[model samples]
Structure formats: C-alpha cells, structure tokens
Target chain A: MTPTLLGRIQTRWVLLWTIGLAWVLVVGPFLPLAGPSVGAVWLAGFRTLLIVSIVGTAWEFVYHGLQQLRWDKDWPTLFGLLVGLNEGAVAYVLLRNGLPLAIPGLTVAPFVWQFGTVWLVVWAVSNGPIRVLFPRWRFAGGRFW
Target chain B: MPRTLDPTDVPTVLGESDIARQGRRVLRRRFVTVGAGLGSLAMIHLWRLAGVADHALCAIGPLASPSDTYELLATNSQIPRHERLRSDSGSTIDAIWGWPGYALREAVEDSHPGSAIQALTEPVLHEFFTPKAGQVYRSVDREAARLGWSRVHQPGWVQMIRRAEGGGYWILAESLDDGPIAIAAEHVHVAIGYPGVQLLADLQQFRTDHPESGFRVANAYEAHGYIHDELLTRPSTVLVRGSGIVASRVLQRLLDDVEHNGAQTTVIHLFRTYVSDAQGDSPFFRRPAGNGFAYQPFNYPKSSWGGQLRARLETLDGEARAELIDGMGGTNTAPRRSWRRQLKRHEGRGTYRQMHGVVEKVVPTSDGVRTTIASADGTVATVDAAYVIDATGLQADPTTHPLYADLLARSGARRNPKGRLAVEPSFEVTGTRSGTGRLYASGAMTLGGHYAGVDSFLGLQYAALRIADDLAETGALPRIGPARSARGWLGWARNRRYDSNGVLA
Candidate 1:
C-alpha cells in the first residue's frame, strides 16, 4: 500500500486553506510592501511563499513542530515546487477560462483581478520556515528551518 | 508522513499478516463486498443488531461500543431520571427493525401497566417515562454480546485512512496494548460523534485570563457538580448561557435544588436570540418553533427524518436549505409541562430571571464575576454571578476530529453550507468514493446536508438503513427482505445470532 500524494496537504486541509487565507486577509496589505515599488514578480513569489509556508505550516501542526513529526526542510521546498506553483497556475487558468461569472456588486474582471492577485500574493509569500524567524516559533531545530 | 508498505505487511499482526488468533484478532481477511465497510457509531450498532458482528463488518473505533460516550452523557445530564428522550420512541439502534419501541417494551417488562401512554403524554400526567438510560445500555450491550461485539469490534484509536494502491482504504488504527492494526476495507463509515465545545472566543479568553477559575466557568457538557454541592446550597446566582435543551435542563436542575434543599438559586437565563412570542409569524405550516425555540417538542419535525419534510429538504439546494436549518435551529426543548411549571414556580418565587444578551466579557470581581453583556435591545448591562455555565452545544466542527481532518486533508471532501460534512442521501461522504470503496457518515458532523435530524436516535438508524440498502444493492450485503428481516428479528428476540448480511450463512 502506498500513501497518496495528498499526504503533503496535512490532515486538517480546511484549517490550512481557511487559517492561511484568514491570516493573510487579516494581515491584509499591511506588510509595508518591502519598498516604494516592489517588483510584481517578487510580490507574487513572496506571497506564494507566505501563504504556503505560514498557513500551510499551521495546518501541518498535528504532524509537525507540536507533534513528534519533525519538520523536514525539503518539505516546503518540494511542496512549493510541486503543489503551490501548480495550484497557482491552475487557479489562474481556471479564473481566466471561466470568463464572466457575475456576482451582486462586482463585475467578473475586477473580481478575478482581486481574487487572482490575492491568490498570487498567498502563493508568492507562503514558503518555508518563515515563521521560525519570529521569536515565538523558534524551537525544534528552528535555527535550521 | 504516510508510508508505502508491502501488502503482506498491513502493519504487523493487525488483521492477519501471519498466524491467526481468537475473537477480534484474525489470521487472514479479504473482501469484494460492495461498500465493504461502514464508519462511526451508526456502523457499530449496525454490525451488532444486523447480527453481522462476526462477519464482513467490524466496528473499529476508540470506544468499546458505539453508545459508550452517549449513554454516559444521558446519565450524567441533569435531566430527570424518568424523563423521556426528545426522540420518537419508535426510533432505535436496531438497524433493521424498530419493534415494541422503548416505552411500551420497558413498561411491559417492568410491569408498569398503562404507563406507556402515560410516558408519551408525560408531564401532563406528571408521570412521563422514556426508556431509562440503563434500559438502552442493557439492550445494546445484550445485543452486542449475542452478536459477539467484542469479537468483531476493534477497540483502537484510528490514525488515518490512506488509499491502498490495490484499491479500497487502508485504515490504520492503534490499540493501546496491541500496537497498530491496519485493516484494508472497501468502505469506511466515519462517525466520531461530537468533540464537546470550543467555547465562544470571549469565554475562551476569559479562561485564559483566569487560569484558576476551575469549574466556575465551563461548557455545559462537562460536569459542574459544584453547582449542587456549593453554589446552590449557598444561595448563589448562576449565569446560564444559551437557550437550547441543555440550558433548559440546567435551569430545571437549579430549580430542583431549590425544591430539595430550599436554596435561594438565582438564575440569570441569558439568550443570544430570544423569541418572546414563540409562535412567530411565517411559521412552517406543519412545523413548530421554526422561528427559534419557544421550546419545540422535538429537535426537528419528526417528518424531517424520512417523511414529507425530508423530501422537501432534499428538493432544496444551497442557501435556501441552509436558511431552513438556521431557522429551525437554536436552543429548543419541548417545554415539558412539568419543567415549565417548575420554571413558573421559581419565577413566581422571584429566584429566576430571563434576559436576552450576548456576553461581551467576563472579568473577575471581588465577590464573584462581573459580566459585561450587550443586550438584544441596544443596551449594555453588568451582571454578577458566582458561576457561569456555557450551555451552548457541542463543538460540531468536523476539523476537530483527526479522521475528518485526514479526510478533508486528502480525500477531497468538502463541508456543506452549514460547515459540516456534505454527504449524499446514502450518507456517503461526497468526495471519498474511489473504485468500489465508498465511505459513509452520519450523526452531528453531517447535520445539514440531506439528513436534518442527523444527530437523533432515529437519524442514526435511518442513515444506517439507507447505507445498508445501498450496500445490499451493490452486493456488499444481502437485502433484508421480509423473510430475512423476520428471521433476524427472531434471532435478536431469542438472543441467538445470525448475520443479516448472510456473511456467516
């Protein structure tokens, strides 16, 4: 018997997507944008790193840091390349292909524009072990992460 | 962190990697039965009552039996010893049958003549009697023994359900003494019951701030016997939160203390939503208390189980259906005549008060606790209570359970509009079907989808019967026609065991 590739997603997938998106939303565009005019590529890449690393890490809490399943440095790196990048691209493609699905106040264009950018921001920033830099989370081979 | 192991090593001496053992420990096992297995408490009872506890089905969970936790709650709750359950008497744990029901059977067996009708009309006669929690326990345990429950019931904490490369699900579970037991089955029924309460944010913060509060503030499900021992005896004021059955029961318990011990129990009944005029406008023509609870007789209209209301619910989709659940939902009780009379007595005695407000904060005061409440009528008020009990219901969040967490994490399952599992009519979890291995679920975690009364006794039986029919249709089980049903009924009556699935035939 073999484990599904979905293993990387963590047991609480809802918490992963939910708490990740929620944390990103609550923090909003409040992270001081790095500089006067950050590169769009850097913005997207940075967000992907943050969303995946932070929220995704939170989801993996049961099997990681708190639990005995030690953090594997290669996990975020591998998942970033394998899952995050692909998810972002697919979400983008789906958003584009499904042209005009209208809601109450907004048109499809702005909706997709906002939705895609947020997803991209999530995709860019959510990478590995960034939380380890925070004073609180530094433990369990935190220096290595 | 899942591992890919050879089929031969399905986790050591799990079901059968090598030598055979007696009872639950097996030598070897394989299956092509349709919907080869089921999950949760519903599955446990099904195996026992269907007399298949020794056959194709085995209930594996962290409990010795399905109703272990539930029976404990029933006994512990302050509900009167003779009080009838809110569910219909005809609904039972017997998967294939609902015979003499609870009241009549108990009445006849106990030699309490004509008490059956009196039990149903209860409170009116000042003498209602549902089956005692003891009766239910004895019945289930009796059936369990007859059907060799311990022999087939795997007592273990399920860790994960990963897809087997050969198809079906590889269920990995750990027994405290026997280590990990991995069983490969075509179907898994997941019913991990309730996970108690995740107190509202403010209450949680209150607990965090006052680490030594002890039982002063706690969920209604957790025992707070101090109410009887210290608070009620000392003429204390209790801040009771929520408006559902638990709230009503707590209020009743307080009043009982007043009567028994002559304690001056001051009750501050707080409600987040109050229906002053319970028979509200636009009421469901056939249903009562659809506009919040003025104490509805039952949880949902009995029809919601499998009658006209259920059919209507099935026809609805998305927001409309969600709105129905919300409308019918809230702290509800049947407003039993005796409980209501007791409440009236207490209120007339000037010891009980009802208020509608959302608690904004709770800060410790010199004598007790000062609560900041924002009233429903655009007003803020302060109330003091020696003890605060959160009667808000169990935390129904599916993500709290590890198995559900694993399912959502991997198997593509999605929560419904109400934030519980979205399941099909067969109670099959929507996204867990792979090859012939289909997964089914029931109980509170699957409340809003197709089954409105998903947590009720009848709901468990209804879901099990529906799933069993689905399995039988797919050749996983034999259809219990009249003959088989009758024979199975007799086996149960005679305390003999015969597998309803024909697995042992």
Candidate 2:
C-alpha cells in the first residue's frame, strides 16, 4: 500500500475507532471471564488501544522514511503483514516494561490474544471491507475518510 | 440531432480559413472527450463526480460503450469473457475511487471467500488477483448506463481539431451516415487507443512476398482462432514469436490444446532476448527472470501507479523521464503456476522448445513457412512451421495514426523524447493550447510523459483526475472537495444522477 503520512495517520485512527474499539468493547468484557485478571480488563483494553494509536503515529514517520529508500515508495502486502508483528511486539514490550505507561492486570496470554486478534482483524478489514465501504480509501493512499 | 449541412461545403482540410464557411453545423459544449474508450469514460465519470451536468459535456466516438473495442481486442488475444485479464484488481475503469474492486465484488457475487483472501494476500502469499474480462465489461456497461453516456455520445469518427475563430476548438468528425459535423468545445481530451497491431519487419515482408500465405501468419491481437482449430484436428508445428504477456497466453492456448484436446502439436518458442535470470540496474530494482520469461505481476511495477516512481516521474522531463521509463519498461508477463507446470511437462516431453535469435526472413513453403534466424554469435538457422503467431504487440506511436499525425502537424503540439505526444504532469498536451481552449491526452498515446503506466486502467484514471483538477483550477468545473465527494459518492451508491444542486433522481 502506498500510504502517505497523512493517509497512514487517518487510516490508523479510523481502524482504531471502528475495529479496534469494537474489539476492545466486545472482547474486553469476556477477557476477565476467561482467565484471572486483577484490574479492570476494559481499562487494560482501552489503555492498550491508546498506546498503539499514539505510538503507531510515530511509527508512520519511520515507515515513511523507509518507504523513500525503496524505488517504488510503497510497501508490499507481505511487508504490511510483517510490520504488524513488529508493532505488536513493540507495544507488548512497552506495556510489559512500563517504559511510557503500564496497563494494569496485563498478562502475557491475555495481551498476546488481544493484540494478535486485533492486528489480524484490522489487517483483514483494511484489505477488504474498507475498500468496499469507502471507495476513496485506496486512491487517497489508504485514507478512508 | 445536428442540423444537416450540405456535403459539398465541407472542406478537405479544416483550418482557421474555413471557420467562416457556411453550411457547417457547429454544436458547442464546455468539454469534449475525443475517444469513447476507458480513458474518455474515466474523464467523464470524474467530471460528473465534480457535478458537471451531461448537457455541458460531449463524448465523440464510434462505439456506444467504452469497453466495446477493449472487449473485442481482449477476446482476440485469447482472453475471452470468462478468462481473467492481466490487469490488477484495483485497476478499475468504471469507478474513479477504485474501491469495491473486482476482487471484492467477485467475492460477494460468487460467495467465494478465496477471491477476497487472494486479493488481500496478492503478489505475496498468493498470485495477484485479476478480474475476468466479462466482469469488467459488465461493470463498465452498468456504469455507462448510470452516467447516461448516450446523452453525451456522438456517433462519428473524429477527423481533426482546429482552433475556433474566437476561443475553444472546432472538432470535426465524419459521421458514417451524415458525412461531416463540427463540435466547438473549450476543452478537448484525446484518448484514441493504440493505432493498430504491429508485425515484425521480417513477418511483414513475408506477408508482402507471399500473398497466398497471408493466413499462415497472424498477429496475436487479431483473430487467429483458425490456427487453434486447425491444430485440434491435425498434427502441426507452430512457431510463436516474441516474449510478452500475449506470447505466453498464446503459448498456453497451444499447450492447453495439446494437453486437453490431445492435439499432436509441436511448439517452437522464439525470443529476441531470452532472460534467464534476474537482471536490472540495481539489486533492489531487479526483476525475476526464468524459463525465458521476465516475471512481473503486472505490465509495470505497482509503484508506478501511485508510488515513488509516480512522484519521481513528475519531477523529470525529456531524456531523464525517458530513461526512467525505459528502466522500468519492456516485455514481461505474470508467472502463473499453471502455465509453468504446463510448459515444464511439455518441455520434458520434447514437444516445446525454445530458440534464441533474431528473425532474418520468413518464406512460404508448401506445408507451412520457413523462418531464417540469426543468433548473436553469427550462427544462422531455419525452422519450418505450419503457423506463426507474432505477439510483438500493438503500435502505440502517435505519429503513425492519421488523426494524431495531423494534430501534431497543425496544432504545434510536440512529441516527447520517446516519440509520444508530450504531456505535462496535468496531462495537458504541451504547446497545444488554443486561446481559452486546452487539449489534454491520456492512454497509450501519452506514454513517456509524466506517468510510466499511462496505458493502464489506473493510469488513465489518474490522468483524468489530474485533468479534472486542472480544469477545476481554471474555473471550468467545481472542485470535488470532501463535502461534494461524499454527496457524489452517495448519489453513486444510490444509482442517482449527479445534479450540481444536490438533487438526486
């Protein structure tokens, strides 16, 4: 996808608000019921969302810089898939180590499940449904709105 | 209906001198798109999206639907209605936004999740998704109907575009039934597709020398199904020339007949320059090559559509732009697994062979044709084949076309370094401005300009968008901002006509 910096930021927020928020609300309530969670699972979910959204904006700058090095100035779908793992790992490390901020009652299994599921859903939606619902998304460099 | 003019009063060559001539019925519009093909269709779609009414626009061409000629050429090249084209899923012509692409639509229509998954993971985990030619045609037809294309369509062959007395241009066209008519418009868009198919020099000479053996040689872009029919019934040796996508398709068709229909066909594949391995100016830019074919998912790199290459090209001009275009240019085909397996099996059986040489001559023989070939090392060889399929591709040079040739001679328009009609980043034909009227061009005729993939579906849309924006800047049409875009898209979804005053239906 050949996303401009603005396009990347806009898509990030759109996905976060729609798919990401829906995942947090629907899956967050069930996370506590599935396993032992100390603090509010919903708080952790919202915190995770906030961290990724803010940090992802910075990642966009880095991605844009890397894009310039390539002749095509675009990322292959494979690269997009791979970058999700990188972003997830970065988010995981920060949440665990409490560098910027910490998510209460966050465990490895729950964090992995939530983060991985959100990434996959977001990726699939962006590649498929987003294009169908918002016709200008692809032409505007992935900016849905 | 246009007012009937006396046939004898029409001038042989329309110019400023004939502007005062009587008996000329001049229909005027704010915009006129010359070729009623995908390019023109895209431009009109964008204009309508920007709230331009149908009455202010005129589309002049012989075909009623934009995809008519495209469908014909595609079918002739072995891509029938059901067969998938070599186009990308997002390279849609009907919709300017390029959303709800063919893949997504196919996924929902056929209830096949695999199509959606394939589109998502294309050129990476899976082969790039290409829509069927029939689906694309159907979509274009539906869109043409929605846009009320009949209202703007002028049934005629555009003869020439001359500057009007005061402003705009006088577009002269010859109606098959009504002789000649003129259209005056402030803006003109030229998108006449490829002039015709191009045959190799030796093959052209061969056709010239042996009149009776004309049917023995055929261009891939033309109807040559008789060869396949003949091969199905009898044993014959077929010689395939060139190494483009069409060459591969033709090869696959022949091998398919051998595999499915049990035809005893021996295929000789010839390549002017056989690419055995990955090669390019730099490692990062290298294209994968194997089995005598250079592999690219599409005709050009995906980035050329809207990525870094597109941005880079806009900043370049003349020889620099031409050099970059050449770097990313050449004959390449997608690497389909089925084609690979078929070729491998045939090669193993000694039925399919590859030859590397330049064709020196082709002479008619009793059974077929004898082709003389010269290798790079000065070695010469001859092969006898019952049929020859030249897949060198279509002629795209604008000078060879009568209309473009005349346009260049009369309109002060210049050719780019690559011998195509020069165009700016906005797709305006350089030096072709007449008073308040401006001439813009797109498609194959405007290749080697600011865009590398000008002939592609997305490329045409990009050119149209650019032209629309340029016209908006000149106060010819309203700018399609966020509010207007949203409203237009709503109308598009509802299948309502686009009215500038926000009225639907």
Candidate 3:
C-alpha cells in the first residue's frame, strides 16, 4: 500500500479497532481455558492490544519518513510483513519493561503466542478480506473510512 | 471546386441543412460516455453504483467491451488468451471495487493458493501475480451481463463533438448499419483510448516504398502472426525493435517456437537506447536495470496511483507536472524470469544477439528486409532479416482522433505540456464547461493530467470515481457514503441488481 502519513494512521486505527479487537476478544477466553493462567488473561489481552495500537501509531510516522526516502513512497507486501516483526519487538520490549502496566503472570510463551497470532490475523485480513469489505481501501491509500 | 466560408460564420450548432443532408437521427440522454471500451464501461459502472437510471445513460462506440479491442491487440502482440497479462491482480477492469480480485478467484478455481500467496508477497519474495487474459475476459463478460450493457450501448463511430444550440453538447456519429446518428447529452465523457499503433518513420517509409514488404514489416500491436508462422517453418532471422514489454513478449514467442517445435530461428534484438545497468539521477529513485532493459513492476511508480507522487502531481502545474511525468514515464517491462532465461540461453547458443543503434533507413530486398543502423559513435552497419517487428508502442496524440480534434477546436480546449488534452483534477476537460454541462475525458488522451497512470485499469477506475464524485456535487447523482458503499458491495457480492434509487434489489 502506497499510504500517505494520514492514510497510514487512519488505516492502522480502523483495522485495530475492528479486526484487531475482534480477534483479541475471540481468543481471549480460550487462552485461560487451554491451561491454568494468572489474573485476568483477557485483561492482559486488552493491555497488549492497547500497547500495539499506541506503539503502532508512533511507528506510522517512522514508516512515513522511510516511505518518502523511497521513490515509490510505497511498501511492498514483504515489507509490510517485515514491519510486523519490528513492531512486535518494540511491543514486546515495552510489555516486559512495564511501560504501561505490568501484568501479574505475563510470561514469554503466552505473550509471544498472543501477540504473534493477533499480528498475523490482522495482517492477513488487511491484505485480503478487508479490501473486499471496503472497496475504497486500496485507492484511498489503504484507508477504508 | 470548393467554396470558402468566413471562419466567424461557422456555427457551433449543426444547422437543419447539415442534419438533413447527413440524414441524422437525434438521441438524447442525461449522460453520454464515448468509447464503449473499458473506460466507458468503468464510468458507467460508477453511475450504476450511484443509482443512475439506465435510460438516463448512453455509451456510444463500435466495440461492446474493452476486451474486444484489448484481446485483438494482445493476440497480435503474441499474448493469447491463456497467456498472463502484465497487470496486478487488483487492477481488474471488470469490477470497480476490485473486490475478490482475479487472484482470489483464480486461486479458488484452480484449487491452489499460489496466486493468493504471490499477491501477498510479490516483488520481493516472488514476482507479481498477473491474471491470464482469458480469466480477465471471462470476468468482464460476467460483469457486463450484470451491468445490462446492451440496454445502454449504441453501436457507432463518433465523428465529431460540438457545442449544441442550448447548453449541452452534440455528438455526431456514423452508424455502419443505420447511417448517421447524433447524441445530445448534458454530461459527456470521452475515453477513446490510444489513437493507433505507431510505426517508426523508417518503417513507414519502407512500407510505402515497397508494398510487398509491408506484409513482412509490421508493428507488434498489429496482426502479424504470419511472421511467426513462416519463421517456424524455415530458418530465418527476425529483427525485433524496442525494449518494452511487447518486445519481450514477441521475443518469448519466437524462442518458444524454437524450443517446442525444434525450429531453427535467429533473433536480432535492436535497442535505440540501451540501459547497461541501474541508472538514475538520485539513489532514491534509481530503477533496476540489466541486459539493456530498465525493469519496473508497472509502467508508473506505485505512489503515482494514490500516495505522495499522486498528491505532488495534483498540486503541480505546467512544466513542473510535465517534468515529474517524464521522470516516471518511459518504456519499461516487468522482469520476467522465463524471458530473461530464454534470452540468456539463446545468446549462449549463437541464435540471439543484441545491437545498439538507430535505424536510419529500411529497404526491402528480394529475400528479406535490410535496415541501416547508426551507432552512438556514428558507426554504420546494415542487417538483413526475414521479418521486423516494431514494438515501440502506440500513438497517443489527441489530434490524431477526429472526434477529439473537433471537440478541442470547437470548445477551445487547451492541451497539456505533453500535448494531451488538459483535464481538471476531476477529469473534466479544461475550457469545455458550458452552462451546467461538462465534458470530462480519461484514458491515454489525458495522460499528462492530474494523474500519471491514466491508461491503466486502476487509473481508469480512479478517474471514474472522481467523475462520479464531481457529478454528485453537481446534484446529478447521490454521493456514495460508507453506508451506500457497503450496500453496493453487498449487492455486487450477491449478484443483486442495482435499483434506480441507489439501492440493491
């Protein structure tokens, strides 16, 4: 998507609220059901969601700068995938360091699983179904609304 | 003998004598979109989404669909139905929304997710996913059926567009079966595509000088299948010109014949300006280049579609916009692995060679055609070949089209720096606004307008969207909001018909 700064910010927020929130809610309850978990795992999911959204918003500015450096001012699909890794790392570091709020039992495995799944689902939907649902998304630089 | 009339006396409106002499029948509509190809179809699709009544719209041209002309040119250029076109998966002309793009549909039909995967990881992990020509044609056919194309389509060749007596425009056309017909519309859209295939001056001179050799020398966009057929039957040298996608396709076709049928064929690929390596003025803007070809995924940069470049171009005027367009515009082809491999394999076997020179002249010999080439240092040489295919691309001059020329003259429309019809950001032709009537144009004729990729499928759709929005502002149709857009997409998905009030039935 050859997104302008505004387009990137708008698309990130829109997809996070819809696709990201929905996926977190659907998978939140199942996490505690899989095995014994600590206090409010769903709450932790919401916390993680909050972190990704806030961190991702900041990341958009960096992406916009990087995009300007390139002639096309666009990111290939592969770059989009790679950015997920970069964002995941940043979110992981912040969550572990208690930047927002520290969870009672936020372990590495669960955090990885939860954060990784959310990222993948969001990315996949944005590339495919989101485009189908919002026809103007691509032409508007990935901004649906 | 011809009689001369005063220039000032010439009327913008056709007189009764002119109409009676031409035996014209007048048809009126609220909207008239010329060029019944992809561009017209795209615009009409937007009108349908806006809930414009079928009776209020008219599309006039000879072809029923864009595929009619596209397939012809494609086949002539060695891209048959089964071959893949150099277009992105989302650049589908069949649907304006571009939902369930060709990749998803093809992936489902073939029971393979390769196309889908390619679409997601293209230009880095893999080459871009391009839909086959047959698949695109089939999709367009389905959409055309749903659009009820026949109800609004009028078969005719547009001859002229002039100011009407009242406020609208009069479109004069000649119907092969029904004689002359004139259309009156408040809103007019011109999307008549490229003027025609351009032949190099040397080739044109050769064709005129030797009529018999005309069959041997031809533009790649024209019908020249006989050259390939003859080459497969005999050992002969073929001179391929240009370094664009068409040239690559033609070269692949020739090499494929040799590989599959064991035909003995030789190819002499000529380049007017060879690109030896990656080169550009700035490191940030350098295009990938190798093997005398400048590689680009598409004709224009991706940003030119909707991002920074698009915004930049829209804000620029005169020479600035033209300069930006020139930097982005040129003859470049997608980097196909198979074509590159074929070139390398043939080069090693002494069956293929590349030469850099300008063709100073071309003359037909008893056995073949001979071309005089001059190199950069003024070194001269001649090469004789059984066939020469000029793949230099098509003519884009607006004046070459009679209808466009007449409209420009009568409406006092100005041309852009690139000599194309100047269009407003809304795709409206400049200086063509009369009262409430507006004349908008798209496609190659408006190449140097606010958009860079005006000729692409996606570019055409973008233009249609802008025009639709403009019409909505003028109270011609309702603006498509999020709710309306959702309804339209659902209707499209469920194969529901569009009602007259912008609702799905």
Instruction: Give me the candidate number with maximum TM-score.
Output: 3
| Model 1, span B337-402: residue lDDT tens | 677778778778788887878888898876677789999889999889888888887788888766
| List of chain B TM-scores, one per candidate | 0.87, 0.95, 0.95
Ranking, lDDT, top scorer first:
3, 2, 1
Q: Best-fitting candidate, measured by lDDT?
A: 3
The DockQ-based order of candidates, best leading, equals: 3, 2, 1
Q: Could you tell me how far off, in angstroms, the CA of residue B179 lies in candidate 3 after the best superposition?
A: 2.3
Measured as a fraction from 0 to 1, the native contacts recovered by model 3 come to 0.59
| Quality of model 2 by C-alpha lDDT | 0.81
Question: For model 1, how big is the iRMS in angstroms?
Answer: 28.9
Looking at model 1, residue B143 earns an lDDT score of 62
The superposed Cα distance between candidate 1 and the true structure at residue A98, in angstroms, equals 71
Please provide, for model 2 over B114-168, each residue's C-alpha lDDT reduced to its tens digit, 9 standing for 90 to 100.
8878887776689889999999998898888777788788888887776676667
Better of 1 and 3 by lDDT: 3
Candidate 3 positional error at B304, Å: 1.7
